[model samples]
Target: MTAALTVSIVVPILNEADNLPKLFEHLHQLTAKPQQIIIVDGGSIDGSFTLAQSLMTEMITIQQSAIDWQVLASSAGRALQMNRGAALASGDVLLFLHADTKLPNQAMTEIALAITQAKWGRFDVHLDSNKLLLKLVGSMINLRSRLSGIATGDQAIFVRRRIFEQLGGYPNQALMEDVEISKRLKAIGKPACLTSKVITSARRWQQHGTWHTILLMWRLRFDYWRGVSPDSLKRHYYNT
Candidate 1:
């Protein structure tokens, strides 16, 4: 009999204290929890690291759910933190989750089934907003991902640990690590493209006008495809 695959969720956080509590709460409510959850702090100044440590300790000493929870510190970069967490993970599959994203019900079960057929995959994602334009944006993102086999960090991207390691993990870049990794993974096999949707925060669009942010992202993506350096793009993304 084949043994069931275990999953390790790696979350890279940066000054996300405001979201940690809800994120942990959502994890606790999962129908099929992951084998372990690794929270890698990326030089947070807002006590995010302390909060994550406290939450992890409380979950271990109180909830005692059969899930292994860990808190780690890493350099201040998503790709760096994620790669560090992946190095410490001990599961057949590794799922990278954003701090502000909540996985859908049975997400672990869905990934388990998807991994059997594909080396990696990602869940569809929707923004947590009632605006019709934002709703349309989510639909367009999902459709584009399915057609291009490319994924963004907002979508919960899961992959077999072996393949992830073999590919040298996420590229050590300032931006577009998710896109780069997806391209490499797609070369080997098409992603499962699960329809289960993860709900991601729409704060970016809310803070910056929806159409403005959308156009900026599109321009950045086009520039990236045109061989513009990620470091340059990162500066532009943050400055704009």
Candidate 2:
């Protein structure tokens, strides 16, 4: 078997105290561990930074592994926080993960193989919900991403460190940073589109009503494509 790539997982967070424990547990259970895990907090007031620091300390002490775990504070924006984490990474590949998502078993091994074939890639995403419609939603999302070569952040996007830095990392926008970066990367080549799925929270759909959330996302993407500024879209997204 080929040696796995050195992967660094960068997770950007804001008020994710409730989800941090489970995310850490998932990391501990990975079939092939990452070289490091960086958690960048966006000035969360919910004690998220402290919790992340505590978890990192405990994980390091218990595992006694060489994995570098860092908890950093950044301005309150997903794009900015992710960029900060990426800047500190020291691995061959960087995987931007969401706190509410859980990678499947063998994710690191799968990514290692995928990276050999493409400069960047993303895993298929499965929404964690029992609703039949939500299951269909997840399937459609995966199919759409596969056909379009555009990845959403929830899919666990991974890329070669060199290429990522060359592209100047994610655009410092309030929204659609994933889509923007995917377009830039696709200009070089299509994404690997791995079959392994990352399970992500369905909280948005649950909170907003599945159909409503789906329609909102489609509308947002259409508006974004039509050249609507991310600042304008952000207000609509958060219903501000």
Candidate 3:
């Protein structure tokens, strides 16, 4: 029998203290004690840093070096932070997840099983909302992954460590890194859709309204494919 595969789950966050504990608790309950968890932060002023410090067992901080806040306006993007987490990862498989998302109980097992079969993938997501528009957005996103091999970070991305590094990690742009990386991964190996699902918060849809949020995300994707600057994309990103 081959050795057990270890998955280093990389989660990138900013001021997400309110969501960290629940996320950790859910993750711990889901995956078996397989490998490690690396939480990369973008210099959050909120309690997120302290919360990470508290979960010092599997959870650890990366790049504790201080950062200039204004750099976010320029380079402190999610892609940069996620790459930092990837650098610190030591698992055979790297699973990139969002801090607010919770994977199903079968996550780690399914990942291990899939990777064992020489497959690589991530958990599909079920948006947490009852509204029809939100459900529609969720369906569209999942369908896009199945049809085009592009998945958002919220769905969770798992890849072999060497394969990820060989691809030179996620792009440094503020947006579209997930799409870009998955495109490359698809060319090298098609990513599987795990039977288990992640319950990602639909707060963005709640805040922006389902139709409006979906339209904006699709437009951003189109613009990115057309080579729009991330700065320009984020300038109009819904932060409220």
Per-residue lDDT over 1-240 for candidate 2, one digit per residue giving the tens place of the 0 to 100 score: 134469999999999999999999899888788898999999999999999999999899988966788999999999999999999999899999999999987988888888888999999988998889999999999999999999999999999999999999999999999999999999999999998889999999999899999999999999999999999999999992
Model 3 C-alpha lDDT per residue in residues 1-240, reported as the tens digit of each score: 125677777878888889977876765555365466777778888867777667543333321321111111113568888788778777888888898888767676777788865446866678998877777777777877877876779998888899889999998776778888888888887778765678899988888777787778878888988989887888778463
**Which residue pairs overlap in candidate 2's backbone?**
none
- Clash numbers, per candidate: 0, 0, 0
TM-score-better candidate, 1 vs 3 = 1
Structural similarity to truth (TM-score) of each candidate:
0.98, 0.98, 0.87
lDDT, model 2: 0.94
- Cα-based lDDT for every prediction: 0.94, 0.94, 0.74
| Highest-scoring model, lDDT | 1
Q: Residue 14 of model 1: what lDDT?
A: 96
**What is the per-residue lDDT of model 1 for residues 146-239, given as tens digits with 9 covering 90 to 100?**
9999999999999999999999999999999999999999999999999989999999999998999999999999999999999999999999
Query: Which runs of model 1 end up more than 4 angstroms from their true locations?
Result: 1-3
Instruction: Estimate candidate 3's alpha-carbon lDDT, on a 0 to 1 scale.
Output: 0.74
lDDT (C-alpha) at residue 153 in model 3: 91
Please list the Cα RMSD from the true structure of every candidate, rounded to 1 decimal place.
Answer: 1.4, 1.2, 5.6
Ranking by lDDT: 1, 2, 3
